[model samples]
Target: MKLKTALLASVLTSAAFAAQAQEVNVMSWGGSYAKSQVEAYHKPFTAEFGIKVNSIDADNPATPIKAQVEAGNVSVDVADVEFSDAVRLCDEGLLEPIDQSMLPAAPDGTPAADDFIEGALQDCAVANIVWSTVVSYNSKNVSGTPTTIADFFDTAKFPGKRGLRKSAKATLEMALMGDGVPAGEVYDMLDTDEGVDRAFAVLDRIKGDIVWWEAGAQPPQLLADGEVVMSTAYNGRIFNAAVAENQPLVVMWDGQILDFDLFVIPKGAPNLENAKKFIAFSTGTKPLADQASWISYGPARKSSGALVGLYSDGKTQMAPHMPTAAANLENALVNNFEFWVDKDAELNERFNAWLAN
Candidate 1:
């Protein structure tokens, strides 16, 4: 009787341990961005909760979320996606609506909704970082420094192959800015047919000199290989290239398109409860601020800003490198999520037709 009782107790303890060892699969853009999350979120979350997190990479995490939800075979538990994708996916009923109340308040007790930046928290998502797509050039390859957006289109002046993301979103906005449209009016201008033509007209000047890139990692590599002298890249990637790799790359912040990357859970996530816990914990003040140490992207919470200091190198100051930094914001365009949510498909179709032409 004593032996049987001991055996039963051991089996129950084993079952409880197995149950407590839940894991979440998180998908994000690979490279420095992924590394930042691993240090700031994944490792800490596991340490705190004993929940294992599986890190996965995709060129764009949003693409797979839609497929997984629609097919009813969701594998991803939590995903890092862009503002527009998060909004669109939520609208299409593909994502689980996040309860903002579950998010931890600021250290001083400010509510999560009040602590996060305006537009950072959405119905189905919570933002993590404010990143920008900006132009970067190899200082060693360029003849003169580029101080403005127009310089990106000036092949005759700068004279080298240019690298651009093969997407219409940032490409159109950057073109308009290069054509001298004010950052505030970029989306307003693109809303008109003539304005779009003007953007394409700007693109026409450098069409022959453009080398297109599709992945986040490609732009930095393109600059390093001298495949293109100037490229529009995620600010963090260029920072890593210059600060981490000791490359001659210089980021031109004049025409940057700033946007947010948010955390969201899919509607049919296998581990919904754990997924929510991960989002709430990872997006808390300290973790969000901790992420800044690994990448140049700005944290979404205003409170996190004060905590941001040096880069992982411990010497490179993160402030000047952030897209939200005062000096850098002078000419930066905030990505119009509503405009993109409505027009992304239409613009991309037109963009693809133009690309093939």
Candidate 2:
């Protein structure tokens, strides 16, 4: 009887240890953005559920997710990806469909679907923040202030290397805007070969003076080091550099491209259930708002806006810094995800060819 009792106790102890060892791997764009998620989501989540979270970083999390899913050796459980990548991966059957029922309601009992901003809740992903890619300049590097998208291409006036993302997505949109295409007509214009040529024509004018950056963190570094007078960068990165680090970086919202970063689960994720739980918890009202305090990106939930009051420093008000603020939205272009979902490959190929020549 004593031996049997001891055996049962040992089995239960092993089970508890096994449960404690369970963890979910999350991938995100590195730098301050990933740090924000760690403070706002990962720490609180591990404390609550006793589940460990392995935080990872990449230039673009979506790339590794697709590779891992296709290779059938899935390691990452959750990833932060752009809206277009989420839709494209889902359509490709590379991601698991996320059921909306798993999400928590708002504090006032509003359903998740109703609480999230339009297009925030996707069939296979849940958005966490609304961020933008904007032109930023070092105050000490230039003589006059650049106020418009056209100014970004006017190297004769600015007269320094310009920083641009190496990708075709936002680069093309901004190029068109620089050439005088209205924000509303950018996608419609890009649908044709003539518009494509026009955007490249603008890029050609400054191609000799352009420095291409591939990572989110590189743009601010490029600007601060004076490698480029002005660079297209993620707004939150510029905000952190200018506000937190006391750098002279400035964000120009005139031709900003707004988009969402969402949480998605790759198909065959090793910790599927934990990934779902993490998504539900991290995208909840408070967590979403808490992330905003650490960075200038706006939360995706309508209810979260009221909770976002100050920067983590406690002195800086966050509203005016957000990409969605009224003043910033005057000439802003919300990214057309559907257009990118269809044209990504074709346009990127063209962009790469242009870079080569």
Q: Best candidate per lDDT, number?
A: 2
Model 2 stretches astray by more than 4 angstroms = 1-17
lDDT digits (tens) for residues 1-357 of candidate 1: 999999999999999877754999999999999999999999999999999999999999999989999999999999999999999999999999999999999998999899999999999999999999999999988998899999999988899999999999999999999988999898889999999889888988888899999889999999999999999999999999899999999999999999999999998998899999999999999999999999999999988999999998889889998999899988989999999999999999988888888
Model 1 lDDT at residue 158: 94
> Candidate 2's residue-wise lDDT over 220-251, tens digit each?
99988999999999999999999999999989
- The lDDT of each candidate is 0.94, 0.96
Q: Please give each candidate's TM-score.
A: 0.95, 0.96
CA displacement after TM-score superposition, residue 43 of candidate 1 (Å): 0.5
Candidate 1 to truth, TM? 0.95
